[model samples]
Target: MSQHVFLRGMVAIRLFSALAELTGALLMWRFQRLETAVRINGLLGLVGPLVLTTTMALGLAGLAQSRLPAARLVWIGAGVGLILWGTRR
Candidate 1:
């Protein structure tokens, strides 16, 4: 895949994630209820991990295409794993 394509995919997903967060915040504000806000927050939570994983995948793919060393790729993957593990509730 082209580097440009990978970069664009990574950026687009992040932008979408941001938009989702904004929309969720607006929905919470519009509803004006704790229960509704919680529900919205719960749904928003899924969006974050999905976006993160997708963006990382695109970055890794681009790196792989560039012939990055296998060890470095493993380290990168491990770093992402640690981030997800550390953030989990």
Candidate 2:
């Protein structure tokens, strides 16, 4: 895919993720119930990682066509892994 496509995809996913979070917060506030808030938060938590992985994947795909070395790519992948691992419960 072209770099423009990759960039657009990455930006779009992040925007969607942001919208989801804002909507989740609004819903939690509107409901004004602990159970409903918790459920919304739980679903938002899933969106976080999915968005992260998708944006990173698009970035990596774009980088794959660039001059960056394979070893650097490995390091980047490891960094992303560490991020996911560190954030896990």
Candidate 3:
């Protein structure tokens, strides 16, 4: 309902998505010595600079655009969807 909500949604979606991707990659590829739960927990730590850059880019592009390529309502709906999807519990 507020810009702050969108901002928080963006942060949550970006962070969780990146962490899930990285953790899945590591667990699926390297980190053979690590436990599956440990590999999953690796995502709980923090992301590096690269993912941060990507997150910033996505937020800026999505929020800063005066008129996004898609309808504003569509974007808002997508953002809501992302937030809902990331926090089902």
Candidate 4:
């Protein structure tokens, strides 16, 4: 509803994204049993980015009608893109 709320949401989203990635990596490393492997990998592979894109879209949408800070927006955009890019492969 407010910029403060959206900013906090973005921070939480970023933090959760990092944690999801870490969890995924840990699971991938520690477990190799066939049955749960795909489930874990699949969950890790798809869910994190889904949440990420959702949050990024929300963050962008929240500022869409407002005049965004150009420099900060660029930096934030780049950082988010970088994270997505790094995690993609």
Candidate 5:
């Protein structure tokens, strides 16, 4: 029973992750083919970087959760830095 519950939780996480990915893809597609000097592409560009950073942060957080609690903060900080850098560039 315990194993089943764990598996169910994992499945739920995977499902939600996939949904998030799909949503991001659709949003990107919606902005694709738009000419330059437009707001949509600029906004969509921000989304890609933010999503990438967030995914990295989530992975880092999960790994840090297993290894060291203190290290999690470092990972989060790095993720935030990356997002900020990406958005600027």
Candidate 6:
């Protein structure tokens, strides 16, 4: 509905796709089953939450982007924090 929403959706989709790839790779490496229905399902399972979070984050960001600059800054800050947290973990 908004630019922020669109961007967030794009980010979520990108993240989900990335996780799917990772899951597929992991399954193939660990199970020796690359072309199975179960592996595809497993990938989708991992991707589902990512898609939801992406949508939620974008929606909140979109709502906040119009009302306050602080909201936007907080979103950016959260993203940076996530990156840092990810790297550290």
Compare the candidates by lDDT and give the number of the best one.
1
lDDT of each: 0.94, 0.92, 0.60, 0.78, 0.60, 0.66
Number of colliding residue pairs in each model: 0, 0, 0, 0, 0, 0
TM-score against native, each model: 0.95, 0.94, 0.35, 0.55, 0.41, 0.40
Q: Candidate 3 residues 1-89, lDDT tens each?
A: 35565578568877687767776776756656557656566555344434554555556555655455567646765775676567555
Top of the candidates by TM-score: 1
- The better candidate by TM-score, 1 or 5, is 1
User: Over 4 Å off in model 4, which ranges?
Assistant: 32-39, 65-89
Q: Mind sharing the TM-score for model 4?
A: 0.55
Count of backbone collisions in candidate 3: 0
Reference-based TM-score, model 5 = 0.41
Q: Residues 9-57, candidate 5: write the lDDT tens digits.
A: 5556656656766766676677675463255446556565555555555
Clashing pairs in 6: none
> Candidate 1, 66: how far from true, in Å?
0.8
Model 1: how far is 40 from its true place, Å? 0.2
Residue-level lDDT of model 1, residues 1-89, one tens digit each, is 68999999999998889899999999999999999999999999988888888899999999999999999999999999999999999
RMSD of 4: 4.8
Judging by lDDT, tell me the better candidate of 2 and 6.
Answer: 2
